[model samples]
Target: MRNSIKSVFAAIVLSIGLFPLAHADDALDASKLYKAGQLNEAIKKIDAVLAQRPKDAQMRFLKGIILTEQNKPAEAITIFSKLTDDYPELPEPYNNLAVLYASNGQYLKASAALEMAIRTNPTYGTAHENLGDVYAKLASQSYDKALQLDSANSTAKLKLNLVKNLIGNTTGGTNPKTNTSNPAPIASIPNTAMVATPPAKVIEPKPVTPTVTKSTAAINEKDNVLDVVESWAKAWSNQNVSKYLAFYAKDFQTPNGESRNTWSEDRRSRIEGKGKINVRIDAPNISIDSNVATVKFKQFYTSDRLSSTSRKTLVLSKQDGKWLIKQERSGN
Candidate 1:
């Protein structure tokens, strides 16, 4: 599986004209081990190398990849963020950072990172595919946009198909809309994630439009969010390219002045390391107005494989009558 993905990424990169432009100081040995699928060994080798040269951005980036594959995404995020801060000109760190976002259902952050990645290297197919996924997530968030948006966007269409394929593969034979909606009881979540405080003011809500409950609806919007969040967790648990992304309004900002996209993506990857995961969401607080709603839950995590749980807030809205997450943020 690893080799196949590498081969595909390489071919995709070559097809798009990306040269293997590792910096002079980059740790080639670790890269080779990572390319060979020896993730743990690559990590150790890079750790030794970085121990001697802690400031090497390329080495850090390479180590981040290995750690991510090893289900150490939080560490990966730290490494990648450091690489980007230390060497903002490099595109790979941004792309990898996007990967972390994607794996956590933080699509907006994934999209933003891919944009930066593309700005640095137009030929980076990983960024393109990732951006495609982000667009696909946006489409998922707003079906009307799917129909209204340009059909010339082959990338979005392709990514939609890819997401469908991935969901299909992961969900046995059930339709993605159905499979992801089947919510298991909330299990214990990792204690590592922060819990966000929901709006305390009980703003007088508008009349609730009666809709099918959790057990029904051709597409249970709330259930769908649960499933998507579940799938996002599973994707990270499996180290599936760390492209999980959640949607949030561009206007949504955290108390700390962080955008919903940035805050949510940061915590999502922090807790959902790249391994197995057991999860539980606090009693969900859901509110709807017309086709828009907010699904507030404190996602808890266990320490077994995927450790740490952060409080999670997902803002969901309806586009064409389908519920879509537009924003996410976490508080612990």
Candidate 2:
């Protein structure tokens, strides 16, 4: 799997070209050294660039890729992590972070990072595909755990074997530790090109009708709905069961078709059982119609024993002038 990831990234880089040549000489020279497999020289060139422009995101990103090729995953992770912090709007750093995490068998963390990547850029196909691979690895772990607890369970055994076969197919059945392939190339750099255009003839303009805009009340309602959703996440993170439950409407639909009271109790137990927990919502997409609103987002969850990321949707409705959750589901 790691080798496949590296191969795909290398292909992407070659196809897309490297960073925009703002500092054309240095950046181009460094990219040339990297492509030549001269990692030591590449690192020195990148370091020299960083020494002058310490916050150059592109150089730092290149350095991270070089570090990964050098088998310095810890250092690479640091670089990518810092990039994500400083440039949360850039999806590439998050994707690279996920790759490093997966290389280390930290699929949960990888999934979370990938979720952030997708949130940053919904059109990023690479991150989306990488996330699927990470999820497969996580499913493999769950199946293995099930077999450990019930060795006699034929179903679990069958699923475990199937997952293992799937993983083996992608990874060439090679142990990650022994697979000494070069790390995947970083293709996150934005490509820039200059094009010359012919002059256009002057044209007359026509008067246009006014565009319709949302009413102030509608805008405020959307804001309120978002506030409610954020508060719910905060409540879950804080383990405030009452507050979390209060965000739901009296007729809230339970995901598993359970009675509302029963569902609340189950949620309470799970929230309180955790030693620590965090729930974050990223890139929330909301649509409002009449009194109802539907919101979809990447939900990242973490606790002492587990971490995961998933796409979640919530249906909210106006109730007594406040937005409350009416229904919830996972995935689109």
Candidate 3:
């Protein structure tokens, strides 16, 4: 059976685009063995090279890939997990981790890993695409559970079928790895008590009119806030450093482990030096309470050489009738 998981794995391998490791010729030899399907020899060669340069990220990455292709997922997971811990700035390992997690039917963990991958490199297109697929899988699980609980429930049945159709359309009906000739339980989600609906009764119309007005106002406010956030994203995408910086409040909290000035300089250089960038937002969830709003969404970013999708959160404070980001975070 054709597997989307394997397809995603192939994309990661292609997207690596990294230079050779310190032991360049040896690493190249190992890579050739891997491509020729001699995983054991590749592993041995890569390990020999790693003995001299244990900290080479590229070699470690290759080893991880070879191990994964060799059906040693647990070992591959260990390598990728350690790489993320040691080199938090690299997005590839996190993306690979998500692939493994998803293959194991751990969609939530996969989603989290993809989020981290995007967080490290917001311009990673592959991660973003995989995240959307993961979300669909999650929705499928939820719908399936509803069907399991109420076998005779027409609404639940209809919803489940609809979700399945959606999943099929989006992912070409690719089954999760948990499904084989004989499938295994993908999750241990417990069933909740389904409340029986009482006979319909007449209610006062007073509650309805005011609720609609309030909802409309809330929606408008949310749209306004989303526009501001979208504009900020656009500025960054366009590589307008000054306009991007302007979106942040004067007292905007700096990123963890970096001084504000240093962070600013780094952001400026990264944005300006990269020739072109494209950023797209998806499924923005915005919550507002008084003068504060929390916005979370998937951020799709692309430059000439890099692309990713990551989860981004913006905490905005309404001041002087304008919304400005006070704090921003990516990933989990």
Candidate 4:
């Protein structure tokens, strides 16, 4: 008798050592915290695990479980969805997420989740029970599953009776459990297990995804003044005289504070007739507020015979859903 007791203790210890019992305790603590309404702290604890091992599916699952208990099943659903995505072979997240969907009134998604769970683990009793629950709510489906999963499941049989009474589908009280379907373990347990979802698996032959480009935002239009005089070089190289000129409003006032000045057709002819010109604009600072935008950039222009440069700021207005250059200046 003493030997048997020691042997049992040894086996229990071995199991704990083999299967990450410490992390599992953390998961359960997080669940308890969520149940006690300490959701933010629960999230922090779970996030700590994720930070340590981002790919840990089981940890992710536990986080979902905690969130679900906290009445944030939508967040739980997202976490479980990631778990299933990372480990398609795992049946747990699918079943858990189905419950999440059910709680959120997404019955169709619930049914799909159950189906995937059953497909991955037909022997999972909790999934089978939940699937029966899903089918029961679908308006006039056979209760074959509740009877099929556990021929003697009192809850299934009781629910089936209520459903039959509502639908008038009396079948002489036949016991479908006696039929020769595969025998599952008679133990009927609902899935109340705290999930530490399995780790994410590496998918093979991943398609290359293009980098997403982001538009740079400017705070208040003119942080970096542009050097427009230098832009003439590459502007000339690209043969885009009009392109460079368009950057400035046609009626831009000159540095000498004259209206309808700078980059005037008269100035263009004077520069082109004299020498080659190169220009570059750099250090642009821009900002957008409400419907207005401002931009400031440095302009540098060099020529064989003479070189000139100036800083510029352009104000833009989003009028009628279009950004149009409204005001241009070579600087104060």
Candidate 5:
């Protein structure tokens, strides 16, 4: 169990990147302390910084990581949970919350938090991976319960043993209860630019013939796909249900196996129900293969009574010189 927990923690650490803060020097000092294994000093430094800038998100996030390292899971959970509420657009807080929840055997809560993380950033690979582990844990619990209800059930016994072995393999055969003291190191959140250097020396200009590259076509395709995605978001935001629906291909996959007409009606209700809506996309990553393009990005959605940030993926296919959404999903 300990090994399994550590692996999950490692995934969380790798997926999160620190946002650049105005107080770079102070934050860097605290980060240095943390990496040097002086968690107490790291906490003190972070706390002092937080006192000066109580609303500093970067410092608050660092403090949460430090708390986790100190094995103060409860305190860490509080910090992360508050961050999620205050900065719903960011996914790291929710990811950390899931880690803390899992450590305490709260798999359901962990799964929910991870889902939120993925919602905020569907391309957040770590959250998706953690959710899978949480589901496995949930399955193991269900099997255990089934055996308790029917001790003579051989199938339940077999499943329970299989789950135990699977979990044991995940933890490298270590007992889950044995290594509760030492926690895994959280990955350092690097600043936007880790190091700064002097500008490169300028060189005299030279004329050269421009040449077309093979990637030019691919680049153009990506740009076209991006434009389509942006226009789709704009249509949805403006409540142009007709235009929005037109962005989908005729063969678009209906979510949850709903009929096309049923899906269209459901979408109409949700979109027209909102008094006003605003949707924005950020940091979109686009990939194209032949006539199909896959785009993933952070989607910020706000209406009269609700505001949320989620990661969304859209699979677009070039049809009649137009990019149309063939499929869409919430997370990667």
Candidate 6:
């Protein structure tokens, strides 16, 4: 999470490192303060700049970074959000908002923000990577919770291990537990001769301990489905054709009444060639019935040349231990 946040900050820093928002000297001073790790001083300097140019986008963006560095997440979020509203075409603010949301453990909000970032700039590789990392983080949290609820759940354990392995590979971190020889078992006990004791009565096995409450399991299941849907939306916004297609089953119904192959090609053209696309999913209604799940939501789509709002529903099927979209349609 820190890595994601830092990468976003690095982008902002590099982009505006030499751009002066205030008077030459003051901007220099502020940049110095920021580099010196005097976040409070940097904030003061940037605030002075903002005072002169109230709506200065660069100044506001700088101040937001300073606030975040000062450990003021709420303030930082407000600043970034305002920037996003004021400069809807800029992807940086949305990326910054995602960093703050992830820091606050609001993965859904973070995912949404990153999606918007990619939509605002479909070629923004940073946002795409950050979105992937967010998915990994969400998966990590879910699988970790599953382990906590049921240590004996082999599936959960295996999934968690796989996630950790992915994270480790991405981060290039070594597994500390690897290659460490175990301490030689403290000397094996010597064989001892013992007289046979009288046969004891057979003991009944103890009742199995309940690993998870029904309420907790329900919540986990709901969260897992939500994560998948969020990821699907993110992949679409990012114009990640491969990842987007992977979320659907081979039998997925085409919303445009076209054959699946034609539909896929159409989606690819629209997503990959659109100048900028912003997709937002809101107020999702999810219902589960065994292996089948239904999700309804408001989808807000925008691009450089057009915008629309529509109700959308997705029918998902649990196949091979994963949720895949089996059908989708637009609604009133």
Candidate 6 clash pair list:
none
> lDDT score, residue 39, model 3?
73
- lDDT by residue (1-332, candidate 2, tens digit) is 42233212222233223335566567667776877778899899989988987877767877887786677989989998987765555677787787778877887898899888775556787777668777777777787788789889899778777766655543322123322233323343331110112124447799898655668667767777777887788678768899999999999989889998899999999998687677879888888998899999999988889899999999998888888999999987
* Model 1: how far residue 212 lies from native, Å: 55
Q: For each candidate, what TM-score against the reference?
A: 0.38, 0.53, 0.51, 0.37, 0.53, 0.48
- In angstroms, give how far residue 304 of model 5 lies from its true place: 9.9
Assess the local accuracy of residue 65 in candidate 3 as a C-alpha lDDT between 0 and 100: 68
Single out the weakest 10-residue window by summed lDDT for candidate 4: 1-10
Ranking of models by lDDT: 2, 5, 6, 3, 4, 1
> In model 2, what is the error at residue 264, expressed in angstroms?
42
Model 2 spans > 4 angstroms off: 2-22, 169-287, 290-332
lDDT, candidate 2, residue 118?
75
For residues 1-332, could you state the per-residue lDDT of candidate 1 as single tens digits?
A: 00001101111122222224443324455555655667678678877876876765545655665566566768878877776655444566777676666566666887777776665555666567557655655555453345348777676566656655433221121111111122121121111011112223568889997876654663465556655554554444334434444333345455577766677677676655544444445566766555666667777665454457677777766665445557667873
* Model 3: lDDT of residue 232: 86
Which is the better candidate, 5 or 6, if ranked by TM-score? 5
TM-score of 4: 0.37
- lDDT score, residue 114, model 4? 83
lDDT (10s digit) by residue, model 5, range 290-318:
88899999999988898999999999999
Minimum summed lDDT over a 10-residue window in model 2 is located at: 190-199
- Look at candidate 2 and tell me the lDDT of residue 191: 19
Which residue pairs clash in candidate 5? Answer: 1-176, 119-310
Question: What is the TM-score (0 to 1) of candidate 6?
Answer: 0.48
lDDT for residue 317 in candidate 5, whole number 0-100: 92
